[model samples]
Target: MNGNRFGRLFQLTTYGESHGDAMGVVVSGCPAGVELSTEDIQRDLDRRKPGQSMITTSRGEPDEVRIQSGLQDGYTTGTPLGMLIENKDARSGKYEPFVTAPRPSHGDFTYSAKFGTRNWGGGGRSSARETVNWVAAGAVAKRVLEASDHDVRIKAHVSQIGDVEAPEVTFEEMLEHSEENEVRCAHPETAEEMREVADQHQTAGDSIGGAIYFECRGVPRGLGAPRFDGVPARLAQAMYSIPAVNDFEYGIGREARTTTGGEYNEDWEFDGNGDPTPVGNDHGGVQGGITTGQPIYGEVTWHPPVSIPKSQRTVDWETREEKEIQVVGRHDPVLPPRAVPVVEAMLYCTVLDFMLLGGRINPDRIDDRPGEYDTDYHPRSPENVDD
Candidate 1:
């Protein structure tokens, strides 16, 4: 019930459950007078909504967003932004059998032990269903990020689906080809292969998992906090809250064990203009807990959806007796393709918060608005930057 809030200055707190009438987020601390609309948030929500492709869940959630407040005349009002999404296609009965017998690889058993009860419908608060709020909030964060006086942009792609690796592509290639594939991968050929893998697993009543790669560009240096908010720590903490995320890695992440310091170290030097330049980004984007102003790249790995249609053994909550039940619920055969946006959202919130903390986002105040403050304050807007 607690611990729903995320970020320091750009905080997001969510409410409601998977099978509840609705789930929503309360986004606070967004600067005043930024352009925003339901369509902006809905665009990101559409990507995360269930039933997008054969590889994802078939829940058929309309996921229509309702902006309860925080915007007036298509611009932010500098108040708490309330966004809601109704659960139109929830069929709690599909999970009736799971009420007593928890599903494998699910939060049911653990949730019960921790909270003394579980919603049991689509895994309740622990469900991937909760991520919709993050996506909605991320949409707003995207705006906040854009308002900054920086050229930063965040994007993610499905780098791997099970054992099928997506063909390597340049960042530009990833941007150009990512939307062309149903799997949201950057390479067309590899996306087809990943889809085939998903089909195979779905037909077999099994599941598969993969990793999502993300790239953050144009981030200004000095955004990282020394300890509690270290770049890696903040990113990893946000990612770990996502359901079924198994592992996290950044540049040279988990790949430096065999090399010496000289081999894996990201060299540092000066550019022709005498500005610091990273020779190579073996440290991802952060060096010594701060941004190197390079394209920060990393990945978060997901395990296969635990709620396979096939019967799996579990325990009776009341009696602790072994039980087997077919988890006849809609689920994603592969997660990375759908998770791409989520990675971007988390990064947006993380980076935007740090930026705000560092005074990088200088927003405007509306004139003649009863609560509007000084209207003369203005900082560089990212949209005006030469990316």
Candidate 2:
């Protein structure tokens, strides 16, 4: 619970449970006077909502966002932004059987072991349902980034489902074709195949895992710090927080194990603007923990939903006896496709917060003809502030 907060400057603290009255987020450090509305955040929540597709959970929660506080006349108030989404269709009775019997590959055991108690209703804080706040918070982060001078754009798509991989696509292609399919894969042929795979798994009462690729363009160089707060470190930390996520890789990632340094090195060259640009993104747009003014790309893998219909063995908390369970709740047959926006949202928070921590970027002044950011907030250094 202590680690529920994320980011250093543009921070978010989420509360509520899977079957709680409402799940919400408190966003802090947002500058005053940025265009914001419930509609802006609701769109992203709709994308994260359940029952959107047959492959996803059939829970009928509308996931409509409500801005509780921190906005005045459609702009941030430089105060904590409060937002919430009510749990309209949680069906806690469906989880009654799980009160004593923990599901396999779920946080039921770990959460109980750590806290001495746990909410058995729909896995409580351990549920993907909690990401409504993340997507909502990410929606705010996107506005912060959009308010800045830089034209940073973030996009993500399902690149792989089960053993099936989508054809490689560019960032623009991802934007164009991701929503064309229910699975949210950019490759039309592969998206069809992924849907078919999900159908097959659904018929068999099994679940499958897959990976998603995320790309962020226009990420200004020098966004992250060296050592502890490196871009990779922050990105990994943000990503691993999502439920069912099992792995995080950037650039060539694990592929580099087979690639020699000589082959991996992408020589730099000057562009039309004389900015140093890498001929290739083999480094995934980062070097030495800093953005290289290139498109930052990475991939995240989510394990299959743990609550499949097939019977699985688990231990009883009270009886200390082994038992079998056929998890009957609604769940996603494939998770990575739905994960695309979540990835984009987390990436936005990480980068936006890093920018805030690094320097002052006034969204209003970013449009100045001179192309200079406003320094209303001097850097939070000892020399800039008085005791």
Candidate 3:
């Protein structure tokens, strides 16, 4: 499709469908000589893969990633990094009925209206399964950022599910506890409550909406431009691109609505190192569309998944009759728990893109040294082999 690509400088173009043979991504513009491996990419994929817990989808796909190109001796080659993940567990029999009937609140109707036909199996290209490729690409971006001179860290956790909300926590707390539970919430007590609520919804054959809290630390200042290319604007595009994400807010977000300028505006001061800094972070690390050299914190709200086991009515375009259908296929009862990794992946890609665009990182190589080919990561000629 036309919109599969994302980012500038460091670009990601994804291909394949949910029920197709495989899902793949091409990550272009990655600098050479960065250490990368199938294990590095698979770690993130396992987090985003289905069947991780009782709250997520039960699909048994292992989500094993195969690196097809763009590496030499475990380092990137500064070319398109091609990776593939097979869809071994995609069951299409359950989706056949919806080909003509169209699932309510799904892309089925819209895709058909626009494209005149679609691969109705497992919602085809419009499925959340498409995000698998995004996580794969983000893994590559994560490695790139890790190899850079800057220390960039990105993390996200389930902040709310239905009515259960986690208390505000420190970045350290999020790092320490977010991945310890199946719900992926930073607070243990709140995570239990969220799990209970998710169970209730699943028992009722319904779904519930939730929110994710994300933070980006160590992003240098002056990485974004004003107006259309602003940091917040680009972040919104990235966060909203994830399916089911209904809203995005950064830096005190909606609370600014009732806040006076005096109460909301952060005063500037000099840090111990004689560097200008904001006294408070009400702007969520962006001031006037550029980064403020502080932690970028925000929340993204997700609508309940449209698919459910509960009966729903839809009109069959071909039969000219209303049909009641129950989405009995495997699906998630709640999304944020598994979405944590996906959110982090996207944040990694976005931050690295800004770094490259701002000239903070080298576009050709992580070492930032041009016209020099003999590097430690480069392979050596075989010592004893004779041609």
Index of the highest-lDDT prediction: 3
Evaluated against the true structure, the overall lDDT of model 2 is 0.87
Model 2 ranges off by over 4 Å: 363-387
lDDT of 2 by residue, 90-156 (tens): 7888787778788888888888889988887888998888898999999999987787777989999
Choose 1 or 3, whichever is better by TM-score: 3
Clashing pairs in 3: none
C-alpha lDDT of residue 76 in model 2: 79
lDDT of 1 by residue, 76-160 (tens): 8889999999999888888887777778877787888888887878788888899999999999999876655577888889889
Candidate number with greatest TM-score: 3
Backbone clash pairs for candidate 1 read: 148-382
Candidate 3 wrong stretches, greater than 4 Å: 368-387
RMSD each, Å: 6.5, 6.1, 2.7
lDDT of 1 at 241: 88
Tens digits of lDDT, candidate 3, 231-275 = 999999999999989999998999999999999978889999899
Model 3 superposed RMSD (Cα) = 2.7
RMSD of 1: 6.5
